[model samples]
Target: MALLHKAHITPTKLELLAAWLPARPWYAGDGPLTRVAAARFDDPAGEVGVETLLVRAGEGPVLHVPVTYRGAPLDGAEEHLIGVTEHSVLGKRWVYDGTADPVYVSTLVEVIRTAGNEAVEEFEVDGGRVSREVDLKLTGSGAEVAPATEITGHRDGDPTVISTATVTLNVNRVPLIVVDPADKGVLSACWTGQETPAVLVHLR
Candidate 1:
């Protein structure tokens, strides 16, 4: 389960993304970034906050930007760091690129291999938790493979390539709309505005 708090966050997620997206090598869009959909995955240890955002500027292709928020900076991952911001309830959070986060990678692979779905998110309210609806409906493609223990390498590009010992995962930076004959992949997603499923990641 993903627990969220209704509190003020300095430099909101959108602001943070707006500031960071322009710096990416492959990002080429103008105007403000609007979120098409969003989703989250659970961290078993309940420490890191894992989330994925599908956003774009103007009529550009949808960008899949996944990130992890932690209380402290991750050592040896400075290159993947997105930024730091203050969360009223969670204190300071260090955000990193999710493709470089082991927790995110493992959970992503697990969901695909087991044909599982995203974690259920709940908001903290008056010392209790209540279920919250997410925009994206994610579906994993089941495959028989060894567990993905680590992310050996990842190249951020149009089709981001992530490699592990067991398998190499290819993530599309620009998510394509579902055509009649859709391509197969490790994961797929759909939202209210989207008519059909869009392939997210696949084995390379």
Candidate 2:
């Protein structure tokens, strides 16, 4: 389960993405971005928050952005750092590109290899717990894979490539809404305007 706080955050996520998106070579946007939906994957250790935001920049196509939130900086990931933000309840958080984060990579590997679903989210409101409705639903196709210990990530234009010695995951930064029948052993998503699952990542 993913615990979400109702507390405020300075320089909201959109603001941070807006600033970072323009610098990425694979990103295509000309104006302000609007949140379309979001998906979350739980970290087994519960120390990291892994989230993927689907946002549209003005009239542009929806973009896939996966980010990880941690209490401290991820060593040797200075280039992937999105920005540090102050969370009212969690104090300070270090945000980084999920592709470069080991926790995100591990959880994603678990999801794909186990044919798993996204996270169960709950919001702490008024000292009470309320289930947070997830607008996006993503599933992974099962595969036999070895656990990943090291994560190396790079971008091939639009797709972010996460690789280990035994496996390679290609994450589509700009996902298409259409589905392909032959795409197996992949992670797919189905959301509000998109009922048919779109291939989000291909593992090889």
For each candidate, how many residue pairs have backbone atoms clashing (under 3 Å)? 0, 0
Residue 15 CA displacement from its true place in model 1, Å: 1.3
TM-scores of the candidates in the order shown: 0.93, 0.95
lDDT of 2 at 60: 84
lDDT: worst 10-residue window of model 2: 149-158
Query: Candidate 1 regions off by >4 Å?
Result: 179-185
After TM-score superposition, the amount by which residue 149's alpha carbon in candidate 1 deviates from its true location, in angstroms, is: 1.0
For every candidate in turn, the CA RMSD to the true structure comes to 1.7, 1.4
State the lDDT of candidate 1 residue by residue for 86-121, as single tens digits: 999889999888888888888888888888887898
Show model 2 residue runs off by greater than 4 Å. Answer: none
Give the CA lDDT, 0 to 100, for residue 71 in model 1. Answer: 95
Per-residue CA lDDT of model 2 for 32-88, tens digit only, reads 899988979998788999997889898888888889999999999999999999999
Candidate 2 achieves a global lDDT of 0.86
CA lDDT, candidate 2, residue 54:
88
